[model samples]
Target: MLIFLDYFLLFFHIALTAFNALGWAFERTRKAHLILILLTLASWTVLSPYFGWGYCPFTDWHWQVKRALGEGPLPGSFIKYCLDGCTGWDSDPVTVTYYTAVIGVVVFLLSCGVNWRAWRKSHHTQSSEIA
Candidate 1:
């Protein structure tokens, strides 16, 4: 059961990371995606600093699972950890945070722009139809 929980958290972490980074490409999922992004930003920016500035609850939870299962030290970010595992690139936590923040902001802005354009286009179409 503990092993299963560990893997589940790992996969869940990966999915959420990817969704935050790329989910904006899908029109149908953008609304929920943006909300999740906002929640993530708030947690990282406004929450208590016990876990540090860019603390991720999911990562903290996963670390608990690892500790319970007697696993070794966990990585800073899931994506960076995976990259290190696959490509053997030793990246520091600070670099991981920098890359993650940049990517997150870019993806978020792109998502908002896409949603805004769609909203404007629909509004214009409706106004034209009424005239």
Candidate 2:
């Protein structure tokens, strides 16, 4: 069961990360993308002082499962772990963290911009109809 959970979390995290990055592109997912990106940013910034920078509860739980599965000491960044596993490249943790942060912020801003534009469009349409 633990192994099953480990795999579940691995794929789930990957999918969530991908969604957080690109979900804003779809009209159906823009709102959810904004919320998820905000949560991700909060996890990285608001909770950083208490949990350290870029802290994610999902990552924390996944790490616990991995540790229970007898994995040796894992890297601090989940992205780093995934990159190393997928590409067989032992990338630097600092570089991974920096890129992860930059990409995350960029995605967040994109999500906000798209959502705002969408909201403004709908709001204008509604006002025009009412008039």
Candidate 3:
């Protein structure tokens, strides 16, 4: 049961990270992308100031599960963690965090821009039809 819980948390963290990075590419996930961007912004602005710049709630919870299961110290960056697992490369957490932040900002802006354009197009069409 505990092992299963740890794996579940691990999977959740990975999926959420991927979704955060690439969700904007799919129209069906645009809404989810907006919510994720807001959540991530809140985490960075509101929670990070209190917890730390690289702080992530999902990662924190996942680490807690790992510790409970007797796993050793966890990696600081989620991207670094995944990369280390796959390639056995030791990555700097700070560098990974910086890269992640850059990617996140780009994706957030893209998601917002795409959604805003869609909203405007729909509104314009509606106004034209009403005339």
Prediction 2 TM-score vs. true: 0.97
User: TM-scores of the models, in the given order?
Assistant: 0.89, 0.97, 0.94
- lDDT, candidates in the order shown: 0.83, 0.93, 0.85
Candidate 1 — what's its lDDT?
0.83
lDDT of 3 at 36: 91
TM-score between candidate 1 and the true structure = 0.89
Q: For each of the candidates, give the backbone clash count.
A: 0, 0, 0
Best-performing candidate as measured by lDDT = 2
Candidate 1 per-residue lDDT over residues 1-131, each given as its tens digit: 88998889878988998899888899898888888888887777777466677778888888788889887777767667778878899888788888888887888798888888888999999999999
Position 44, candidate 3: lDDT: 75
Q: Candidate 2 — which residues are off by over 4 angstroms?
A: none
What tens digits encode model 3's per-residue C-alpha lDDT throughout 4-30?
988898888888888998888898999
